[model samples]
Target: MTSKIKNNTEKPTSGIRAIAEELGISIATVDRALHDRGRISEKTRARVLQVAEQLNYHPNRAARDLRLNRRFRVSINFPTGIPPFFDALRSGIEEGALPFSSTLDIEFHSYSLPYDHARNSIQSALDASVDGIIAVPPNTFQMAELVRKANMKGIPIVCISTDVPESGRLTAITAYPFNCGAMAAEALFSHMNKRGSVGVLTGNLEYLNHAEKVRGFRTMLSQLSPAFSVAAVIEAHDDPHEAYQGVRRLLQSTPKMAGLYISTANSISALTALREAGRLDSVAVVTTDLIPELVPYLREGIVKATIYQCPETQGSLAIRTLYWYLSEGMRPLHFIGVIPQLIIRSNLDLYISTNKYIAR
Candidate 1:
């Protein structure tokens, strides 16, 4: 008998076709079963899915997108400050866009904090006719105007990490700002045994997120125990030197200061002051954000606890919500607030590993 020659030129069957062949059904039936697109008998649909799974088959997302001609451009406007937090947010944005890689073109614009550096970026994206926008909007007249312009142009904009209420954007996604501060207050209250004067080292109140933390901390603390009071609320302007000097003064002047709440990610400055004053053991410190720099302090109990703002979730939700709205006309809630986590020494390892904050 003549040896049969192998057809090396023949290509392997495509995922859908292989599934169809195995299930003894047509490709159209397999497609309908997989996508729930048309009427198909349940038995056939189940058989198609089981065979597809056994064959380790997956559809080519890029091919599907090209066939459907579904593509969109989205612009991301985020701050460049506080690398630990901001970097995590960036990673979240990337993770959120991975599934849509075949069809989504994302343009990331980084800006400095406490300024409206995103004005030009937003304007440029609008000029380019981007499909959607995700931003950390500052409360600036220029930002408001840009947001309004995008709305007029029919481009949906979603704010992350912070909200500009009057900007008239689509919606805002953030870690619950009020609860972030309230959680810190609760931690400090418990750590200090429910009776102590706590000082707040915060960033600028102009940023609504910062102000909300202070407000929530004060509100919760007062309701928890009138005996526990907020001694001083200093706006450090997110400056290391200013935060250090402010904390030093609080350490010197605030008599028997039992607790301190560093309500911004710029907490290393305040923590340094406490360490220098040799009061790290005396004061119950509650800080915001989980950065690599804070891990050592948390382990040593210099930081009694910290509020993790779930920056990744904020980033992912912002992108996903905007994409869904752009592609499928899906509308999310006016405000999506992720619950913040309180990280203490006992659970430090649970959230911290090298530079990454693992979301639980």
Candidate 2:
């Protein structure tokens, strides 16, 4: 009994603590150096590693697994307006979290178009003390403050679809908005012979994504030809009724308008207005996203093209990024932009069948 007790209390040197003791460093430094995490000095890390190898130390896999067994609560905050696009995002989030369902409890917080609702949802998540957040930042200055609070509280936040660059988000998973807009402009130009005024119907330009698309569309058109000019940048606010009314007024006011670019996923509303105004067949239109509603218009050649901004992929990646960070303490890149794809009538059917959420 005496021999056994002595052996137990001897501090038998084999684990991370032993390495710390041998090097006269803290256990945290030893661990960080061993895992190659955080911002530790390379010289110290090298020393810690050398001592770990010399001692023939190996981490206990069973113990590490046990330590990581605790469940994490992650909040998903997004806006609701375009059902097809936002639904795809939700599906991607769910599918991405499926493999780790046992380890994560995902809470969804969806708000409507005013964007203040989104701000409130994020605040609620903060109050609940969620482990991580995946969100689409509202077009509000308050978003920056929310991001600051989350960062201060040691909660990582990832943005999807759009971004607030100054908000200190962990990462943004989105399409290159500028490129999406430029692609639309090119498509419209091709259909219009680069000599007609194009009307841009979009959401609030205060949002970075919307503004970027407008800027890209305008810039590309300018480069294409001086005769090709932007007639108007109409703000439909992503409202079906407002979009319908807004496009109707534009078509009436600008009878000579040769093209229309629906920069948001408000294509159906705008298209209906155009059809009602007897201008759908006349105006060469470029729309955003490929929803079932837009399929009929595309096949009939009423829409020249639609920019596909992989909303499903954005959702999946956002959750995956947050999960890896929370589980393994890995840092994700600042921005992960999904490349946008242009879909016309020819390629529309292929996307319709394979679109993950659409098929579901």
Candidate 3:
């Protein structure tokens, strides 16, 4: 875990100029090191940061905010799904950007694949000359090229929700899917009796988050429930209708299926399939996300459990990380994984209302 820097409650005094003077380096070099731009050696960057810390040289941005000369354009692109999940995320980003209103300009961009039929919303962001990006990229090798292009332009990228770790992003802010999947599997296993085949419903493997979740679920099942083998691993493309059909197919093929593990937020459809199959009570099911659609199922004892990845905090941290890097030259950690919450019928109400997914 990356330790957070304590906010110095003392009023801000001094500026980068003071630190530059003491370091005896050109102000431009100091600026590059602070902003993590240009070709500066590790030694100089460390030296500049150390002296800045000694003098408590925090930039006084109130004046800069007034000028509004240095405007930052940030683009947010999320997957196509229920509004509550993405809406909660966007709300946090808007909240984090509130203090920097004068100097920041945000534009929300929509992107989808297989469903929306558009594979290049990210390219559009680049075409529009966005200074930075926050996105949920599909689990595909093609994203590597886009990320490489962005880095070449010095445009920072932060991946949210699902991450493309190999894309060379500034950082990835996520509710760690591997652990989340394992948690969901453990919940499902505990609720199930002795031995029967359990089905794993996943989104497209092209999305890294969905793939990571399946990996975690499978790993946990192997470790915990050796008797319950995964009868089928189906990809639902994260679409509600598609997930419904996929589950129905699983039930048709595997008549003795005892449990279902859904690794994405398409539960409303999958649950419908289960109910239609008349096996809702017979088969134990665990899903992800605490959206409104899934809530009713949990309350009625139809859906056994869900794993909630706090969308608000993920969104808030993505914006804040970029702002600190762009505004204050704070170099964020490459990967910061936030653990997800295991939501059962009893604790469902709290997670739905409070948005609290802190590490236990």
Candidate 1 deviant stretches above 4 angstroms: 1-65, 140-142, 353-360
Per-residue alpha-carbon lDDT of candidate 1 for residues 231-334, written as tens digits (9 for 90 to 100): 89999877788999999998888869999999889999788888889898889999998877888889888898999888888888887788667765667899
Off by over 4 Å in 3: 1-68, 115-119, 355-360
Report the poorest 10 consecutive residues by lDDT, candidate 2.
Answer: 1-10
Better of 2 and 3 by TM-score: 2
Question: Which lDDT values do the candidates have, in the order given?
Answer: 0.80, 0.83, 0.79
lDDT of 3 by residue, 1-360 (tens): 111222223333346778878988888888777667799999999998898889767454423544656767888877666566787788788777666666777788766646333238778888888889988887566787788788898888998887777877899988998888898889999888888899988878877788888889889988996898899889988777888888889999999998999887777888888888899999999988777767778988878888888777888889878977777657799887777988888987677566532211
Please state the error at residue 240 of candidate 2 in Å: 0.4
lDDT of 1: 0.80
Model 2, which residues run further than 4 Å from truth? 1-67, 356-360
Estimate TM-scores for all models.
Answer: 0.79, 0.82, 0.81
